[model samples]
Target chain A: MSTKDNPSESGRRNFFKLAAAGSLGALMASTPLKKVLAQVQDPEKPATNIADALKIPKTETSMPGKFPGKVVKVFDAQSVVEDKPVKTAAYQMLSDAMLQLTGAATLSEAWLMFVQPHEKIGLKLNPIGGKLLSSSHEVVQSVIEQLLEAGIPKENIVLWDRREFQLHEAGFTADAYPGIAITGTEKKDADGSYYNKEGKLYSEEMIDKDWFYFADVDGEYDDYTLPYMVNAGKYSYFTKILTQDLDKIINIPILKNAGSSITLCLKNLGYGVITNTGRLHAKLWGDTSAEVCCFPPVRDKVVLNVVDGLRGCYQGGPGANPQYICNYNTLLVGTDAVAVDRIGYDIVLKKRIEEGIQQEDSPRGRQFMEYAAQLGLGEADIEKIDLVEVIK
Target chain B: MKNTLILFLFLFAGNCFAQQPFVLRDDVLPDITSVNTRLFDKDGLWGYINGGADLYLEYGFEQVTVFDIKAGGIDYKADVYRMASPEAAFGIFSISRFKCQESARITPDDCLTPYQYIAAKGNFYFSISNSSGSPEAQVHLLAIAGNLLEQIENLSIEKPSLFNYEMLGPHLSGLKYISGQLGMQNGFVRWEPLFQQSKNYTAWIMPVKQDGSIFYVALVDFSDSADMETFMQKNGLTASNGLNQVVGNKIYTLFIKQNNRLVLTEGVIPESLRDYLEKF
Candidate 1:
């Protein structure tokens, strides 16, 4: 029945809808976008917090249900209209990629396979790479469109990242895309601190009190005293939204070469899901890239990972620089985060090796992948991964 | 592979490259003093390198003297990035080789863009981006590069003896010096996981083919023979003194410490490495 919800089959979709959406993007550029920010800011806005929501219990684990290390698909197209992500081309790439990854004959079937109609889905984006290299709005819109056609209400889907500033820098605000709840775990944008700019700690009520893990590494856990540590592994706390608000999380990470080696799904959700990530982060050298992503809270929540490799950077990144910016025009999709990252690491590693700067199997990122695989996170070896490619 | 034999002969020219240091003289570009220089220290490194500031910083970057040369009423931008040594200079230039297309017959050991010229000379890796893209600008770019290479010839770094350059079949043009974490992670050092960044070791990679780091012999120079041996002993990599210890997968990696230098060869037969080490 879910497979029968295709816009084409229902005749609900038309070309004019696309034209109107493009016009909306231009309009969003000029004005103070979505007015939903005020409503969602309340910790109790939805009335039912994560603790109560988990009791409504899901019978099934959602799409890509069991870490099916089956295959990672890559679809690339250089469709930049005046150096910007083109809507139609991006939509085509996403549709093709998702269908191939899930082996679904139709588009609507692919979406239903991921979530039930009433389930809340959170789309986590990586925006540290800034405007040009961050997650493309066009790509997000394509995903949103597919979700809408799948019978999921727009208000039920939330687009989130670690810091509000980075999300803003990535060019999406609550108002930017109306109906969708665009927000973050941190109250403000990254002010070089994990905590808010005002130095106030995030409310513990947002993190799942019982379902948390700690690396047990030596460091002062900042937000431990906030009465939220239902179990204080303190440093790494899963946000309440991750624990409660969304039933399925769609990891949308920017594909770029990182000083941390490669910032794909593993790094995006691993680091993005926790608090006091400062203890885990080390630029140029990977410190906690392994155990961070291996934690139960972050790993268990992610159902699908679609890497935004379209307009990405090759060298100086996860902090975007124009010089290293490349238009690979690719989208990599997979259920297994490590397998996807291992492939991403290889792609980025090949580029770095060509640049004569990096080598394969460096102790950091590559090792984290191996550790993830060992923990049954996903496939890390090239032999184990089945790669599907569609280039346009 | 014949490049190795040619490289063996080229190693002797290390002294030749270290001789000249002022190639950007008045003759290279008419009225060269009109070239204004902006000295960028660590704090202000971004003022010169921009996005690539941290790249140079990790390479023991000291300062960058960016010379904005005005000649024949054309603005030619030349940046002389000064690292700690010739190897650091070479390392900086090596990483910058990618993304540049349309190679000109300019610098023999450099990556040239359509409007830019890049090369390493002694302790300085320099680049010249010609805005005008005129015939006169091309001539000045070449002339300035040639003179600078000759001037800094004597300051060029010499290859460490551990590599046994004479036995090297032909892999010389693919060499660059580095000394930090970037070097260690890029096959310059064998796996230790806890590898520390240092200026004590001078690491350089010589890829086996066009673009690959997996199969290469990395020549690493330690402070002395004791230090080299101590590193081998401490890290349990001691496969020297008439013996060779091979490590790694995908590529057959061989690590041998002789004298003050450590030879890490990947993809080469361990049996042949003995004869190579004996030749040095």
Candidate 2:
């Protein structure tokens, strides 16, 4: 190994000593930030001076971020519970979130700023985890009330997810609540295939053939051509529900750790919207899942993220393992999915670590976050994220 | 020692589903209301628990005996991971550390909390958590946990005798034991790479606090002396005289060999504190 490969203990001590002395700002400002950044980033390059070692590269986050400092708003009300008929706590939480997210003087104004009368809005509800740990009905009710107050007609609003069976199993049905269109692309039948009871195939008219983005992995499932793009054939086709069906989406994802680390806004869309996700996870924690959000269907379409932290799963989740679940009773909201997911990832990771689970990093979801950032989707770095915590 | 009940369950003649070889007894806690379990093997475990289930399975976890204990209108969740062997039980147990400032001795070779508990017994590594927390709740949990432990007949690995508590100092909360790496990016204010490498080889770590200051004292035993020397040289600390060689910036490191074990320690403590060590 080269002499530059191994830095001495004095070198490390000097770095800490500089930290203690609070010369970090002077050191960071002394040199051209980018040039000094390159040397410190290099594994093989040994530290020549304490200043060079001290330099940290400021993350070049995506500009014109929707939320200030790429922040996600997290609101928790200890009062939000399952037994209550009307969620008195959820209304407070939602109102506080809207007032902060849009910086409106009132909750109605915040909702109005986002929802115009012309656009048909979709409230994407994730009910996959079912009764124990899915999006709370009371939380959704708060969203509906806000949208109505904002001047959007009841007919213009729709609450939907992947399959109607899951939606129904999650306690959402069109007939159960009149005047609100609660629907799905297809109904999951007894055999677990997507089909409408009326005998229409879900893949037929529902999936927009022209608007799909393809990953084009090894074997050809469908007879489509010229389907290769971005990051070496990490191909996928976007859901028409996220693309053509709705003009905008208000994401309601449950907080849980997927087998691949975290299943927040990114995974909710990446896996929930795509047709062929099995091919992606086969890579064993790579950037494939991250690249899915880079597509416009999720990246541009999602206007709000309200993570259902009311009851969260630290382990054995995105499934109903009630043993690993806990009640956080908080809702995390932000415009940027990357920022929102990063915070959600930390919450779950901390719980896992406390439970004595060893993880190298949030390796699977983390890289995908960086890929999203690399594509100018949103800010993935934690330092740049401005977290807004609201206690209701 | 593995949980003997696991093999004992297989020997019985009854409805195979009714009695799992390894499960907590129903009447362990006086106030126990109900019980629930989540287990992982080759197939069902994949959709179970958090990210590190694979690590436990690799450490010989045949099943994770998760118990949901309901008592006094409060619920506590306990997980008894029955590893294939006692060695596997301890290896996986390395991932957990005492989260408090100092662990109150409620059980031998264990850490306790009314809200949470971690202990390694035979081939079973047990963890208990209750969102319902209080001194009374903790007392109930300990009683429930203690009795539950008594019911399990399994082989276990003792806490390493190598750790010299007096010399290591009293900041027991700062101590950690893991056969796995600490996820440092060169993590936590850029001490990542150093902690990442130094932690996995660690048998024990203690934060020696004095004069309102804390110095991290650690004992890492490497399998090979040559590798230990390489590790010392690579970190730019080549010990010149007994344990004082890597000293710098209020940080002290000692590299020693006791037989095949390469016991290394680095911290922000005085070098004279090395006199406190006693071999396993």
Candidate 3:
């Protein structure tokens, strides 16, 4: 009953396409040819090893899962009280959004549509913003409660991110969620050291060597950055948690902006589950964000995207800048990562315009969403999306 | 005074070599809970900011010193970025400032929001933030900023002569300085497509609001004539056309090209700006 086993007929066709694409590509490794390849490449758009990730086929449980081109936004004025996210309000917001998204009569029914009692669920969080604008604990609690109501055991759930300490700094701890496994790809030892006795980063052990996203550009990290990036080279490996530890993924990204673009569903899951991402951001951010999810480990597992928009930054974001922080007091839920991101982008864009951050819409901001759509991930066109809004 | 200025320049240069500019002395603010500082060089910037470091690097970064201060029961984080030039520092500051509540009393190029204060002076961009935007926290934040600015004084940046006019004094807060695509995307997004074709340029934009209508005046300094020529060709601008005004559905644009610079106005252009457009 493993979710990975069964594939639809269309999935099989994609599998053959992937096998065909990887035949000659898998043989080409990091070599002197890389220098020659770099010379002819677009200096602006650097060549990435995205073909390597697409070698594996998408599965039945792939992105835009049960429902595609559908997004449900639940808003409540009382979601935050005295700057703190109210847990009860969050629970109700999520409950209503999921029911509307799935058209389910009960909360458990809506939860069961995306998960089962047997599957291991992973909640990927964005904690880069720290306490000011990180993914709220109230939303996470509401999600966990719904999963439990659907009969999934607490031990079957795990909380994870790229950095372990950052998750703790954002207030995700064992004491907070008892029996639930809390982990990250990059970890520090009990004595506050990034390296173990062997002088190798603990992050290196968490990566799956078999799975990697190969970009033509090389990343050179200094001693200070090495701990954060884990490795420096042409390869960015996928974390084992996505490859083996989790059977299903529920992406929980804070509703935030990265310049003109929104860092919603794909940006979180794309950048969160991979190592050596510090290099990809400069030239290949939009491409890596779309291509990384094409890999089977992520594409086939991410079933849901829950955006915590209760408190988010409208201007200087993807990182926390307190001046731009606003109380959105809304939760956006969708099975389609791209569609969810599109809606989230609109929300942030409207806020930015209202704040007079920018004069009008910037096409550059929507490039990532368009790229994600071109890759057949989900819907990016605003007109095609079926948005269901629930006001409480 | 000249000798003191020379000594200050020498100290500033020496400070770069020494790597520690000025440490926050505990004695200065006795009521402060704690002050922690960390330095990020070119190689280690990604460690602190992750992907957000790319835009800063694109604008030309040297290093940044971050300070974490807990005072008056509020947590504050301040970052002082040393950029390649005054323009680069101002470019970063212009894009980062949101709906500024009021101008900071320190420098003309400064914004003070409820939770953040951003300013640019010389080759340094300073950003200070607090978790709680209480009046007490803001007072402590300003004290810290004032102290930090006092340590490095008499450093100023050269600006375009157009900014010196008294007409723009009230609208100075709406000004934006941009150098690259990242800055364009963040600050002046409406002009992103027009600037996207050009390789190297610096632009300063000022927005004026009158009678509930907002319009913009922008001056772009192109690095080379070839880039300017290409820009003119792409946007249908020619010297022969003289004052070219294109009317769109929502806005009216006036394009004026001079040598390697372009002065443009959008929306309801003010008569003063239109009169000044002839001089360019």
Candidate whose lDDT is highest: 3
State which candidate, 1 or 3, has the greater TM-score: 3
- Docking level for model 1: incorrect
Model 2 docking grade: incorrect
Instruction: Give, for candidate 2 chain A, the lowest lDDT window spanning 10 residues.
Output: A223-232
Using Cα atoms, each model's DockQ against the true complex is 0.05, 0.04, 0.61
Model 3 misplaced regions, further than 4 Å: A1-44, A51-55, B1-21, B27-31, B240-242, B247-259
Error of 1 at B208 (Å): 8.5
In model 1 chain B, the worst 10-residue window by lDDT is B1-10
lDDT of 1 by residue, A70-90 (tens): 554555556565457788888
Query: What digit string (tens of lDDT, one per residue) describes model 3 on residues B19-94?
Result: 3347455544435676667788888898888888888988988888888877666788888888888888888987
The RMSD of every model to the true structure, in order and in angstroms, is 15.3, 13.7, 5.9
**Residue B263, model 1: Cα distance from true site in angstroms:** 6.3
List the per-model TM-score of the A chain. Answer: 0.74, 0.73, 0.90
Per-residue accuracy of model 2 over B77-169 as CA lDDT, tens digit each: 777676666555655444343344225354444666445666666666777766555667677667656865775554445445544456553
Model 3: per-residue Cα lDDT at residue B277: 67
* lDDT rank order: 3, 1, 2
